[model samples]
Target: MEQILETLLFASDEPLTLARLREILTPGTSEPRDDGQDSVAVEIKQALAAIRARYSREDSPVVILEVAEGYQFATNPRYAAWIKKLFKDRTSFRLSQAALETLAIISYRQPITRAEIEEIRGVEVIAALETLLEKNLVRVSGRKETVGRPILYATTPEFLRQFGLRSLQDLPVVDENASQGEEAAPFIPDQGAQNPMAPPATDHQNN
Candidate 1:
């Protein structure tokens, strides 16, 4: 069963959750087992641990990782430099500057509609939005309650992990503080400007 799980994970393009594994394994009643345990949870946990230990070996080619609450196998991080160098000239996976700006706006003003983003940037951003979606950095959270019911966008868990933020509120903000309570950048938008999607003011600065 563990070997089956490993093979399925290796063949899968996306991370597989425990529930998904259960669905696949349940139908294979004749599968062999090591611990003779009937509790699926215990067996799964044990299997995961064993897999972790096995990959801890220095010679392993792939490593299993738990990301976004699912398990997947990826080439070991130690080999990442070589993998990156192999694809250094590829442009498909890289983002353009405009796309990055659009993504920043979406990240900060998530659950926002396309119209709102356009309003803030003073430009259409369809391509940027599509690129971000393709990269799995953003997703459709829901539709706006407005007349057209435009789709709302929000960052994914992958975004948080990539940025090393524990939560959304941990995102940095430009300070407006001064000694003795004097205002700095008083004319600049406050918390609202903190939105990732907001266009940068002429004097705006990152924290």
Candidate 2:
């Protein structure tokens, strides 16, 4: 079960939630019995533990992490500097701090108006919003039912794919301070490190 779970999580681009894991582990059940489901949950928990322990070994290049309420493997952060060197000159565009902050705001507060986003972020967000749209992370979902009928923005599937999220429900609970005054986000290859989808970055910033 540990090997199976490890393979599934490692192969998935998005996070796999507990329910989703259960579905994949046990297919075609109209209503799983409570006792059976409980046992299955325990098995998955144990497997996850073993998998985490195995990847924590010193020789491993990646480690599994719970992000967006699901598990995905990430390169160990301690090796980021060295890893950056390998793709430093490639065609990649790292989202700027402002872009990240705007993205975080939009991620948590989806179907939000640009006005509301600016209010929360306390700055003009046109450029950041444009950058996010260009990256295919944010999209105009609909028009708000307000005086101006402002265009609303929500995260796209690409956002989930890039961030390893199963769904909006999987977003990490945000404290007020963290939401408003968040700092620069560390770079994670929006696309795989080996294949950058954007043009080459001269200043290592996407925005």
Candidate 3:
């Protein structure tokens, strides 16, 4: 079971949830294990734990990480320098400062309208929002319920994967010492620590 889990994690480009793992292991069935164990759920947990422990050594080059509400294998950041050299020609998307700030606001206060984001940034965010949308990092979740029913924006799963975050809960804590109405610094993932998935190259347009 551990070997199968390891192979699946290694071959997958995206994170795999426990539910997803179970489906892959035992498709079209929700029945409990016949061996009298707790359940497939418990068995998967044990397998994952063993896999994690096997790669937890100080010299391990790859590690299992929970990102985007799922588990994935990621290269160790310590070896990032060497790995980057091999993928130097791969396309990477770089976010502008304006877009970064807008994204930060949306991430912290999601299901928000464009007007609400503009209100906080004190400037128009159309271009920044467009850039984010083009990059598939931000998405239109739905519309607000109030008058006009303005569109609401939120971060995408790609955002979490790109930033190597397990979830929004992994976002950096907002500074409490800032003055009222001050815009907090945006959270930027370390270039060296980003997930190995490289987004397609697009024209670099400043926001």
| Top model number, TM-score | 3
All candidates: CA RMSD (Å):
12.9, 9.1, 8.5
Q: Which pairs clash inside model 2? A: none
User: Against the true structure, candidate 2 has what lDDT?
Assistant: 0.73
Error of 3 at 10 (Å): 1.9
CA error at residue 59 for candidate 1, angstroms: 4.2
Task: Give the clash count for model 1.
Answer: 4
Query: Clash pairs of candidate 1?
Result: 104-196, 105-196, 105-197, 108-196
Which residue pairs of candidate 3 clash?
A: none
Which residue ranges in model 3 land beyond 4 Å of their true spot? Answer: 29-38, 91-93, 173-207
TM-score of 3: 0.75
For model 1, the stretches where C-alpha displacement exceeds 4 angstroms are: 28-38, 85-89, 96-109, 118-127, 134-136, 139-142, 155-207
Query: lDDT tens string, model 2, 1-207?
Result: 887888898889877776678789998644433464577766787788766565554335566666555667787554666667888887665899999999999998888999999999889999999999999999999999999999999998778757755567656665656766676444333321222332232333232
TM-score of each: 0.57, 0.64, 0.75
Backbone Cα, N, C clashes tallied per candidate: 4, 0, 0
**Better-scoring candidate (TM-score), 2 or 3:** 3
